[model samples]
Target: MGIRSVLSKPLAKWVVERQREWMYRPAEAQQRWMQRLIKGGQNTVFGRDHRLTDVRTVEEFRQAVPVRDYEDLKPYIEQILNGDSDVLWKGKPLYLAKTSGTTSGTKYIPITRDSIPNHIDSARDALLNYIHETGNGAFLDGKLIFLSGSPELDQKAGIHVGRLSGIANHHVPGYLRTNQLPSYETNVIDDWETKLERIIDETIDQPMSLISGIPPWVQMYFDRIQERTGKKIKDVFPDFSVFVYGGVNFEPYRAKLFDSIGKRIDSIETYPASEGFIAFQDSQTEEGLLMLLDSGIFFEFIAADEYFSDNPRRLTIDEVELNKNYAVIINNNAGLWGYSIGDTVKFVSRDPYRLLVTGRIKHFISAFGEHVIGEEVEKALTDAMSKHPETEVVEFTVAPMVSPAEGLPYHEWLVEFATPPHNPAQFARDVDTRLTQLNVYYDDLITGSILQPLRLTSLPRGAFQQYMKSLGKLGGQNKVPRLSNDRKIADGLMGVVSGK
Candidate 1:
C-alpha cells in the first residue's frame, strides 16, 4: 500500500466509529437529546418564539412553528426590557447571547435553560472528537482560552448578537474556561477597545494551555498580548496545546499566526451560530465530524447545489443522504423548524454524519469568523465614512484572500470615492478604525500578524455604472458577495470599487 493509505487506515476506522456513533440515531433514540435541549432552551422555545410550551406533540411543534428572523420577534423582545419574565419563556431568561444574524444586524439572541444545551451538547461532542483525534484533551484540561465576544447586550430593542455570545460563555462550566470578556451580568456595549482592554488586563498575568475563538480576533489578541506583556503571545503561553477556531477559514490566518508565534499548535475547527451550535472538527486532520445533536434538534438537509430550487430535496438526520453538500435546516426543540439560517455545508460522510464548510452559501464574510454579512459590512462602511464626507464612496466590496506568499492575505479595499483620500495609508487607518467598532473580527484581522496590511485602491465613478451595463444583471437581486475566497469573483469587484 502507498505510505499515505497505510497511515490513514487506522484513522479511517476511528472516523467510521465516531460517525456511526453519531448518525444512526433514530427519532425514538433522541429522547434525551430532545429533553436536554427543551429544558435548556426554555427561553427560545417557550419565551420569545412561543413554540416550546405550546408544542406538546413533536409534529404540532414542528408545523405550527413559523420560521422567524430576528425582526419577526422584535416586538416581543422590547417587552423583555424591564427584566420581564411573562413575555419570555419560563423563569427570567438566564441571559442574552449577543450574536450577529443576517437581517437583524447585531442582536441580543435570547438564551434560556431550553436553549443553552443545544450549544453545550454540540460543543461537547465536537470537543470529544477533537480530544480523541489529537489526544491533547489532557492539556486542554488546563487553562483554556475561548476568544468569543463580551456576551452583553445594550438593553435596546434590536437583536444584539453579543447577547447570544454572553449566554454561551455563561452556560459553559467555569472549570473548563479561562478569562472571557465583559461578564454576562455586565452591560458593556462590546466596544472593541473597551472589551480588549478588559480581556488583556484580566488575562495578562495568567497562563493558558489552550485558546479558542474566531481566527481574526485571536490574531488581534496575539498583537495586543505582545504590546502589553512585551513577550510574544506564543512565549507567554509556551505550552499552548490546542487552537480551537470557528467562523472563518483558518487557511488564510494559519501561517502568520503560528509562524510568528514560532510554534505548532493543534487547530480545532468549530461550527456554531446564532441559531444553534452546529458541528466541529473531530481531529486536527480529519474533516469535521458533524456530531448530530439528536436531542436538541431534528436536522433537515437541503441540497446545497439545488438550494433555491422549486423542489429542493431535504433529508432529515435519520434520512440524510451520503456525500452531498446540504444546506442545513433545523427543527430546534426550541421551536425553529426547517429554518434556513443561511449556511452551506458539504457532507463528508453520512453514516456518522460529518460535514465540511465549503463556502458561504449566504451573503456573509467570515474574514474573522464573526459571521458579518453583506448588509453589516455595507452599513458599517457607510456609517464610518459618513462623517469624513471627503470621500463619497460610490461602491465597494470586502473579501478575505489567502496570500500567495504566506499568512492571511490582507484585505484590499475596492472603493469608489468622490474626493478620495489622497493618502492611501492614512485612509486605510480611518477605515480600519470604523470597521473595528462594527465587528471585532474585522478589527482584529487588521491588527494581527495573521493578516496583511490593509490597502486602499480607489476606483473611478463611472466604473460600477459601466459594469452593470455589460453583465445584464440590472439589480433585481444582485446582492454582493461579502466573503469571496474565489480570486476571480474578487477581481470582478475591482471594476465597481475603482470605477475602472
Candidate 2:
C-alpha cells in the first residue's frame, strides 16, 4: 500500500468514531445544533424578524417562524444579493449556490463559513465510514473523478456564485487534490457533451479508482467510454472500487449501471441539496442514509399526507416514527429559517436516524386522489425487474392519463429500456400488480372501475436523453422527475415516441 493508503485506515476509524458521538444521540445533537443556529441567527435580520432571540425550544422556534419555501425567503435573499451583510446570517455569505427554480426563475442559496463544513466534511465522512467498515482505503492511491458542473464561478454581491458542485470543488482537501481527476481546464468546459469528451480524453488512461456523480450522468460517461474502447468500465479502470452518487435515487439505474461496469461495486448514496448536505449512507449493510444531526442544521418533519394542510405539525427527531413519510424542513446556520427544501423522506431506522429519500413533496401522481409517491413506483418497478431478470431499464416517468381516447383514463408509464423485457406485457402487468399492493388507493380506484390498469409506452432508446437535451438540461445534476401530477413531461415525450 502507498503512504496515504497506510495512513487512511487509522484516519477512517477516528472519523467514524467521532461520527458515532452524534449519530447515537441524534435528538441531543439536533438540540445543540438548534441552539447554535439560533445563537448565530439572533443578531441577523431574519432572526430578529422571526423572534429567534426569544425562542427557547423547538416548538417556540416553530411558533415564531412558519415553514417557508424559496419564494417566502426571497426577500431576505434579495438583501444578500444586493450586497447586504448580516441580512440572513451574521455577515455576507461565503458563497451563493445558484440553482434552477420552478416557480422562481433562479435561486441563490447561502453557504456561510459555518455551513460550508457540513457539505465538505459530510462527504469525507461517508467515504471514511466505508473505509473503516470494509478496511479498504487503497482507492485513495488512484485517481478519483467527480462528474460535476463547471468550477469556474461568477461573482454576485461580492460573493462567489456557482453550482453547489462547483463551489465544493474549491473545498476539496489538499490530501486528495493530487488524486482528483479532470484538469481544471477540462472541468471548466460549460458544455456538458464537450466537457464529457474532454474528461474521457484526460482520464481514459489514468488509474481511476473512485468515481462520483449523479447516476445518469455517470452512466452516460460509461456509455461514452464503451463507445470509444468497446470495453466495460471495469476493464478500463481495474482499480475502480467505489461509486458515490446523489441528487436522485440509484435503484432504477442500478442494474444498467452495474451492467456497464460488468460487476457490482461498493456504492454510497447521499442526500444533498443547494441548501445543505442532509445525509449519507454510513454502512453498506444499512437500509438508509445516516442523517447528520450535528451538521449545523436542525431538522423538522411534517407528515407527507398532512404537508399541504394548514397548521401541519412539525415534529422533532425524537418524535418521528419509522416507515412514515415526512416532508423535511430545516433551520440552519446558513440563515435559512424553517426552510422547506420540498423533499420527503421515511425513517427506516430511528435508533440512529437512518432515512430513505421517499420522493419530492411536489412530485407525485394524485390526479385521481390516489397519491402514488416516488418510493412506491420505484419499488414496484424494482420488484418487477427482480422477477424478470432478463430486463434492464434505462429511464422512466409516470403521469396520469386523465382523458384517454379509449376506455377509462389510467396512469401512463413512459419507459426507456436498455434491454427490452422478454415478455413486455407480463412485465407491465407485474409492475402494475406490485404498485397496487404498495398503494391501496390505486387498487381501490382500479377495483371501482374509476381507472384502467397503467398503460406502458415503450420509449425509443435515448428518448429521455433527447428530451432533456432539447431543454438544455442534458447533464450535470439535472435529472428527469420520476413522476409528475400533470402531463407536461408526458406530452413533451410524445414527439420522441415515433422511433419506437
Candidate 3:
C-alpha cells in the first residue's frame, strides 16, 4: 500500500462517520450548533445586546437579532478595529480578513481564534470527504499546489490583516506543509505575474498530484505551464488526479480546464468565503454541496424574492426546500450575528442538505425590470458556449445600457475570448435566446420591443487584464463581477479596450 493509503485511513473513517451523523440527524445537528454558537458568544457585547443569554429557541434568537448587511454591522467592526475586546466574540479576533468591497472601499472581516480552527478543519474535511468517496487516497502521496493570495500580512491594531487565503496559508497543518508546493517565498509574492512565474519555476518538475485555486488564476497557471513545457498538464504532472476549485462557478471554466489536462480529472467545488467555510462537495454522485451542519457556522436562508420585503421569512435547514433560491444568512464563531454574506444559493437536496450557489445578491441587472441575475447570465453564456465548442470565454461581464439616445436600451456584454467562435453574432443570438427562455420578464421585454437585443462587444485580447490592473485587483481571488445593474463597469471595460 502507498504511504497515503496508510496515513489517510483514519481520516477517511472519521469523515465517513461524521458524514453519516450529519445525514441521519441533520436537524438535531443544526439545533445543537445553534445552541453552541449562541452560548459561546453570549458574554460578548453583541450577544448581550441581542439577548442571546436569555434566548433558548431559534425563533427567539431570530426575533432578537435582525438580519444585517455590512452597513448595519460597520459600527461593531469599527469597535473591533479600534482595539476593543469582547465586542463580537468572547475574545478579540486573531486576524481581520481584508476583502474587496462593493459600495464601500475595503472590508475587514473578523477571523477569531475559535473560528480559525473551524476554517482549517472544514477545508481539510472537504478534501478528506472527496478521498473517502472516491477511494483515491493516493493523491496525498504527491505534492499539492494551492494558488492562494500572498501570505504577507499587515498588522492592524494588534490583529493580522490580509486576504483569507493568505491567512489560511499560515494555519496549514505542519504535516501537510512539506507536501505543499510553491515554497513560502513564492507564496508571499504579491504581484500575480511574478508570483505565478516563480510558482511555475518551483513546481514545474515536482511530483504534482493535486492543484487547487479559483478557476481564472488556475487557468492562467495551466496556460503558462503548457506554454513553457509544450505539453499538456497531464504530461507535465503524470500523477495529477484532481483539480479543486471554489469562489466562482466552475461551469464556464470546466471544459477548458479538463481539455488542458488532456483527460478527465475529478474536481471538488466548495463554497468558502472570508466569513466562513460554509459548504463543500461531499458526494460525487450528488449534484450540490453538502451543508456542513456542525462546522461552527449557523445558517439561515431567506428566499431571494422575499429578501427585500418589509418582513422576510427566515427559513432554517428544516424549512428549506429543493431548487429554491435563498439569500444565505450566517452566524458563526467569528462573532458575526445574522450577517448576510450577500451570496445566494439554491438547495438541490434536503436530506443532509446540499446546495448550489446561485449568484451574488447585489450582482444583477434589473434595468427595464428584467431582473437578470448572475445565474441566468452564466447559464445563458454556458448554453452559448455549448453551441460553439471551439469558443472559450477567458473573461466576461454584462451590464445594462439605459436611456440610449439612438436605440432602445439593451444589455451590453464585454467578452474577452481565448478562442473566438466561428460566428460571434450567432453566439450572441444564442445567449439572448437562452436568457429569454430562462427569464419571463426578459422575454416580455423583448417581445414587446421595450428593449433591443443584447449588444455584443468583443473585447480585444487582454482587455480584462488591463482593466483589472487599472483597478489594482489584478489577481488572487479578485474576479470580474459577472453582471452589473448599470453601465459603469462595462463603460470602464470599453474605455480600457479602446485605450481612450
Q: Among these predicted structures, which one has the highest TM-score?
A: 2
TM-score of each: 0.59, 0.98, 0.97
Q: What is the C-alpha local distance difference test score of candidate 3? A: 0.89
Residue pairs with backbone overlap in model 3: none
Candidate 2 C-alpha lDDT tens digits along 1-500 = 98878888999989988988987888899899888888988999888888888999877988898999999999999999888899989989999999998788889999999999999999898898889999888999999999998889999989999999999999999999998989999999888889999999999999999999998899999999999999999999999999999988788889999999999999988988989999999999979999998989999999999999988999999999999999999989888888999999999998788999999999999999999999999999999999989788889999999988889999999999999789999999999999999999999999999999998999987888888877888888898999898999998888756632
Worst 10 residues of 3 by lDDT: 1-10
How many times do residue backbones clash in model 3?
0
Model 3 stretches with alpha carbons more than 4 Å out: none
Output the worst ten-in-a-row residue range by lDDT, candidate 2.
491-500
Candidate 2: where is the Cα deviation over 4 Å? 497-500
Q: Predict model 2's lDDT versus the native.
A: 0.92
Each model's number of backbone clashes?
Answer: 34, 0, 0
TM-score winner, 1 or 3? 3
Order of candidate numbers by TM-score, starting with the best: 2, 3, 1
